[model samples]
Target: MMQPDTLTVFYDGGCPLCRREIATYRALKPQGVRWINVADARPAAGGGTGSACPLDRAALLARFHVQRPDGRMVSGARAFILLWHRVPRFRWLGRVAGTPPLPALLEGGYRLFLRLRPWIVRRAVRDKRAAPPG
Candidate 1:
């Protein structure tokens, strides 16, 4: 059930890919969706509470996470499922993916991403550092 109240999502702000994806979602201004940076455990510049999800910073940063209305914390594909429900544009995805078989598939993919995340972050950082400042 999508709560009209708020969904606190914890993400890795330090990761370029994570930042870009979150920025896209933020641009939509999804209803009741609060973005938080795991790196600092602070609400995004947009809005929300500074301390919402009471979880270890390292665990939150290690994977995608979301704090449900009931205060239950979910991670990885499950977290994304919670997130999609909050965003109108992606609600369908949340429904379709929530069903059997789909969740397993999504979780598998998410796990793969987790394994590659470090390398991806490193490459992005290297590229950014190499770019000549304008």
Candidate 2:
């Protein structure tokens, strides 16, 4: 069971970009945070320290999601802000981004990025495949 103050992060492990970014965060060893890979068939079933996700697997996989210690679900840019605040070196960025206007602007950018993500991932995969092995 998770502590009352623990935060849960749900992410799409199937996406290469998501995997790489989550790996970076995991490397940081952020405190009081739990990472869940929604891409797995049984992600919410005995996968972490908490109960099953309140949202369905598809919904969880579709966007960034974070479960606050208060049991509130936050998504998109706001979710990112919450996550950043918990990360050691990213607290300042989170605070700034959470400031008025910035959150709205960031959400807009995130939406655009989501729309372009499929194309971006395809191109990245192609490029990686074309690159010569070292």
Best by lDDT: 2
| Candidate 1 wrong stretches, greater than 4 Å | 1-4, 42-52, 128-134
lDDT score of residue 99 within candidate 2: 100
Cα shift from native, residue 25, model 1 (Å): 0.5
Per-residue lDDT of model 2, residues 28-122, tens digit only: 88899988888764644544323456787777877999999988999999999999988888889999999999999999999999999999999
lDDT of each residue in 22-124, candidate 1, tens digit only: 9888887788887788776555343433575567676777889898878888999989988987776988999999999998899999999999988988998
TM-score of each: 0.81, 0.91
Question: Could you tell me how far off, in angstroms, the CA of residue 43 lies in candidate 1 after the best superposition?
Answer: 13
lDDT of 2: 0.87
Worst 10 residues of 1 by lDDT: 41-50
